[model samples]
Target: MYVYRSHDQQLLNERVAQFRDQTRRYLDGQLSDDEFLPLRLQNGLYIQRYAPMLRVSVPYGMLSSTQLRALARVARQWDKGYCHVSTRQNIQYNWPALEDVPDILAALADVEMHAIQTSGNCIRNVTTDEFAGINGKEIEDPRPWCEIIRQWATFNPEFAYLPRKFKIAVNAVPDEDPALIGVHDIGVQVLQRDGETGFRVLAGGGLGRTPMTGEVIGEFVPWPDLLAYLEAILRVYNKYGNRDNKYKARIKILVKALGAEKFRALTEAEFAELKDGPMTLTAEEVDAMRSHFSAPAYDAIDDQPPALQDALASDKAFNRWYHTNVTRHRQAGYAAVTLTLKKTGRAPGDITDEELEAVADLADQFSFGEARTTHQQNMVLGDVRQDQLFTLWQRLDALGFATPNLKLLTDLVACPGGDFCSLANAKSLPIAEEIQRHFEDMDYLHDLGPIDVNISGCMNACGHHHIGHIGILGVDKKGREYYQITLGGRGDKTSRIGEKLGPSFDTEQVVPIIARLIDLYVEQRQPGEQFIDTYERLGIDPFKERAYATDH
Candidate 1:
């Protein structure tokens, strides 16, 4: 985790005080709704369906135990007893009072965290793979570069307000899109060739009403010109993006309208003016950022220790949790463990205050006091020891975090829809819960194999429904709630927007429809073929026909 320097602390403190006054003036009726709207949004406070929702940025999804505790405290004191993890790996408090948000921001500032740039039409949080620093296949650790981008984008007067909200993702691993970079407004692929580091930059990719994958705008942007090149891309969008209509204002629409080739030419023209300017990164600056993310002092031990093997053999439950939740780490004898937030009966991604505190304790004990939030809406202990797997599993299970459904149908991503969000067309949490309850059979799910089921209340795609292997999107039909389904979409290396299945179904029909789709997959799938593979091989017609069948 990056420790805040003196300047960083000063900036956050000043911002908190500034927002505090802004909030006070608004509450006192000194500022009009229109006047306070942008101010509140810039501070991450939103007027939701019921109360104000405050989103706190977890930069690049990283969190220290102390920061986790601060979040837990905020949840306990300000809002409900629990908070929801968003699809972007940020935290949202759904019940904060409008006047209390400033105090919440101040509290978060104490732990070197804030909500700046988390909302409004500006550069949002720069996301990356949760396993950035520890993943074995990474060409370079992306956290340092993510930090560099974060510092540059935050409070950058040039882009304080874009035509619409913009998102960026960094992927350091080769041939993988764990960060879902292909769907971000700007995707940074960290590449190394000929012993030189550079980036492959993609632009214009996004989801929502208009979902599309990005194109490679910069084939190879040298490491030194990263910031300058990024500035050029932003410059192009800021200059030409649609401001008249909110619906068609995303960079994706602009990129699509201009075409990738012409868009690239414009960006190149901008780069010609900004290249090698003051925005260019020096080697020392990169190193300084990297210093904040230096590897922890790891112990030397076998990857598969005798104790771990014995525990796996003795306890079937622990073995299941280990295989599902635990992932390989670059360091031998260490593993990255995901604390599943998709438990049945609870809203997906919702974690209680007590669970937050317990998770912080677990991180301090097992992962060197560090943890990460996944874009999939789960918490990750990124540096757990292989030998302590059983103990950690037991602790997590007691806290209801060990559901053993990583990447499975039950481990879905969803947003706080109509229940909390005013923007939603229908409720999403109930749909997610219904799906989770319908797919609770562990053996059946494991047999079905890795699948991503993403749900969103509307086309905002906050749940990233477009990328799920099976996507469920809520819709409003004659003031009634309905769900439209999509199949074969994935967020991996082969990223693509899902193809929808015919007409929408009512709330009660969603689970049975999903059951029908799963049944088709089971009956038609070959040995070792996952749900996605079967869908791709047979295409959407079979699944769509089966899903909408009268008997189903």
Candidate 2:
């Protein structure tokens, strides 16, 4: 984790003071509700259905143990003793008093974190792959690039008041775990080819009312021209993206109307003049930024730890957890361990204060004092020694943080639906719970294999329902809660939007429909095929027919 400079610290301190005073004025009736809306939103405060929600940014989903401890303390003291991790890899406290939020921000600032730009239509959190530097297949760590973009976008004068919120994701690997080259307003994939590194830029992709995968505007934008190219894209969007209807205001709509060819032309025209201008990213500056994210030093150790093998042989639960939650690291003797948020009957992504504290302690003990939050709504210890895997699993299990389900049906990605969000038309948590209940057997899930089931409360696609292998979007049909199922959607390198499967199902019917869909897949799938692969091999028709079959 990088520490802030004295100037940056002072700026944040002053901003906190400013927000504290603004909060006081609002509480004292000096500022009207309407008047304070944008101000509060800019500070990452949202008035939810029950109480005020405060979203805290975890830059690129990276957090220090100290920051985790602070977050736990804030949750315990200022709000409910629980926090929700969101799809953008930020954490949200569902109940915080308006006055207490400034204190929370101050606490975050102390740890080089803040809620600034977590909301309010400006460039939001710059998310990258959680396994950035550690993944064996990664070409380069995208975190440094993400950090560069974060700094460039934060409080940017020209882009702060755009027609709609903008999102950008970057991936350094060819596999695209962050799905960075997919449905973002601007998707960037860092690639190394022919002895040079640069970005493959995609423009005008988003998932909301209209879902479109970004089109590749620049196949190979040299590393030196990244910022200038990004500036050109933003400038083009700022000038032409619709502002008349909020629904049509996103850059995706503009791209759709203009068509990808014309949009590419427009961006190229803008890029021509700005290629080597003031904002150009020089090699020296890129190298300087890269130095900040150099891989952590590790002591040489045996690749296979004898103690871990003994523990795995002796303990069934630990073995299951180790097998499911742990991943291979590029470092020979290290592992990246996922701390799953999905416990039976608990809300997906909800972590209690005690669990947070325990995770913080574990991060210090096992992961070199740093942890990561995945866009899949789980936490990760990216640098655990292979020998310590069993010990970590035991501790996590004791703290209720270890769930032996990763990429299973139970490990769902969901948005806070009608229960908390005003935009949601139906409750997402209940649907997640219902599905979890339906698929409790580990054998059944393991057989199903690497299924991504995402549910969104509504069409905003906050939970990334459009990209799930089996996507569920909550819809309201005449005030009744109904869920629309989409199959064959994937968010990986070969990304595709899900196709709808006939009529929507009522709340009770949703789970059974999902089961039927899975059953169809299992029956039709060739040996050893994952759900997404199977879906690709044989299209949505087979699953759709079986899911809606009248054999019951």
Candidate 3:
């Protein structure tokens, strides 16, 4: 993790002091709720449905063991004994007292983390692939660029009060880990053309009441011009993006109304003005930032660990974990171990303090003292020695973090809906729980295979239902919870928005309808084909027909 300089440290410390005072005033009734709203939001405190929820930013989702320990301590002392990892790769505490939030922010700043830009209509945490630097397929590490953007956008004067919340994601690999880049406020993918590396910039992609994929404005922005290009886009959005109706305020709406070509022209004109400004990223500066993210040192070991092989041979549980939770690493003897949070009946992405401590210990012992939070709301201990796999698994299992259901139907990503969020239309956690109980059979899940069953309490797409292999979106029909299903959506190399499968189903009928849809896929799929592949091969007609069938 990058350490802050004395000047930067002073700035943050002073900001903490400011927030501490503000919080006191708010509690003392010196500040009205309306007056304190923006201040509280700026400090990452939200007055939720039941209590205040504080979202802590884990910038680019990178955390040191010390930082992880700090997080554990905060969770234990100030809030609940557990934290929910968000879809944006940040952490949220659901039950924090409004007054204690400043203390929490102070603790976070001690570890060089803060809640700035984690909420409100500004650039929320700039997310990237969890496998960023360590991925074998990366063109170049995108973290440096991400950090550059983080600094530039942090309290950026002009963009702080945009029409709506903005989000950005970058992936250096050909395969997109965090899907629907086309649907973000700004989606950047690092690409190489000939011998030069740069970005393919997409703007105005978003999902909510109205969902649209982003359009590519700049196909290949050279590495040195990253900030300049980004500023240009932000400028255009700030100057002309919608502000009349809150619902139509996202850049996605502007891009749609203006068309991609017109938007591109506006951004290009802005770019020409500030191509060599102070915000422009230079190779030297980029290199300096890159040094902070250099790969950890590793000891040479055999690619196939005999101990792992022996465990796989003897233990069916270990074999199942190896097949599902483990991913190939760039290093010969290393693997990326995904610690699934979707343990049967537990809430997805919820990690207890004890589990956090255990993960920190495992990272120190076998994962080069580092761990990553995936966009799918899971954790990855990258750089794990293959020989240490069994030992790590045992420790994680004891901590209740060993769920061998990665990419499976039961490994669903759901938002903290009516339970915590004030904006949610329905309870999403129960829906997820219902689905998990409905499909507890490992054999059935394995047979179904690699299905992304993403659910959101509403169309805000916080759970990214827009790109799920099977997207389930909650709708409120006359104050009753209903679900609308979509099919054939994918978030990988071939990204596409899902097509809706007709009428919405009542809450009671949703899970059974999903089961029927899966059964139809099973019946029609070619041997060994996954749900997504089968959907692509056969299209939506078969699944739609079965899903709406009266018998089902």
Candidate 4:
């Protein structure tokens, strides 16, 4: 994690003081609601369906134990007793009083965290794979570059407010894209060619009412000119993106309207002028960013030690959790373990204040005092030792974090919909809970194989429904809650938007309809096939026909 320097702390302090005055003025009628709206939004405060929701940024999903403890304390004092981890790897306090948000911001700043640019029409938190530096297949650690981008984008005068909100993601792993970069407004793929580091940049990808995958704009942007190139792309979008219709204001719409080729040409033209400008990164600057993320001390030992082997051989539950929740680490004797927030009956991603402290303790004891928030709405202990796997599993189990359902159907991704978000057309948590309850059997879940079931309460696609293998979208139908399903979508190395099945189903019908879809998948799957594999082979017709078929 990048430690905050004096200047960083000073900036946060100033911002908090400024926002505190702004909030007070708003409360006292010195500032109008219109005047205070953007001011609050830029600081990550949103007036939701109930109270205010505050989103605290977790850059590239990194969190120190001290930061987690601070969040727990804030949750306990100022807001509800729990916080929700957003799909963007940010944390949200759903019940914070509007007046206390500045206080919360001050508390977060005390621990080197803030909510700047979290909700405004600016470049939001720059996210990467939760296991950015730890993933074994990564060509390079993307976190340093992510930090570079974060520094550049945060409060950049030119892009403080664009046509709509912009999001950028970085992916360094060659084989897989755990970062889901393809769906970001700008996607960066770190690459090395002929001993020269560069980037493959994509633009205009986004998920909303107009969901589309990003297209390649810069085939190979040199390492030094990365920011210059990004500036060029943003310049194009800022100048050309629609400002008239909020629905059509995204860069994706602009890229679609102008076409990727013309957009690339525009970006290249802009880049040519700014290629060697002040924004061009130097070796010293890159090294300084890298210094902030030096590798942790590791013991020289081989993986799968005798203790780990014994635990795997002896305990069925530990083996299951290991196979499901744990991922291979770049370092030999270490593993990355995801603590599932998608436990049955709980709102996906909701962690209590006590649980937050427990996670902090776990990080301190096992993961070098660092933790990560995953885009899947889970927390990760990224540096856990392979030999201590059993002990860690026991601790997680005690905290109800060892769910053994990673990538399984029960491990679904969803947003806090009508329950919190005023923009939501219907509630999403109940439907997610219904599906989880319906498939609570671990044997059946594992047998069903890896499936991404993303649910969104509206077309905003906060739940990333467009990218799920089984996508459920809540729709408003004549003032009634109805859900529309999509099949064969994925957010991986090969990303694609899902295709709709048929008409929408009411709230009561959603779970049963999902059950029918699952039954159809189980029957049609080939030997050792995952749900996505079967969906691609069979396409939407078979699933659609069976999903809407009447019971005999």
Which ranges in model 1 have alpha carbons more than 4 Å from their true place? Answer: none
In angstroms, the error of model 3 at 519 is: 0.5
- Listed per model in order, the count of residue pairs whose N, CA or C atoms clash below 3 Å is 0, 0, 3, 0
TM-score of each: 0.99, 0.97, 0.97, 0.99
lDDT of 4 by residue, 446-490 (tens): 889899999999999999999999999999988989999998889
Task: Encode model 2's per-residue lDDT on 71-151: one tens digit a residue.
Answer: 898999998899989988999999999878888999888887788888877788888888988988888888889888988
Write down the worst ten-residue block by lDDT for model 1. Answer: 543-552
Can you give the lDDT of residue 432 in candidate 1? 90
Task: Report the C-alpha displacement of residue 157, candidate 4, in angstroms.
Answer: 0.8
Extract clashing residue pairs from model 3. 182-214, 183-205, 183-206
lDDT of each: 0.92, 0.86, 0.85, 0.93
- Residue pairs clashing, model 2: none
The lDDT, on a scale of 0 to 1, for candidate 2 is: 0.86
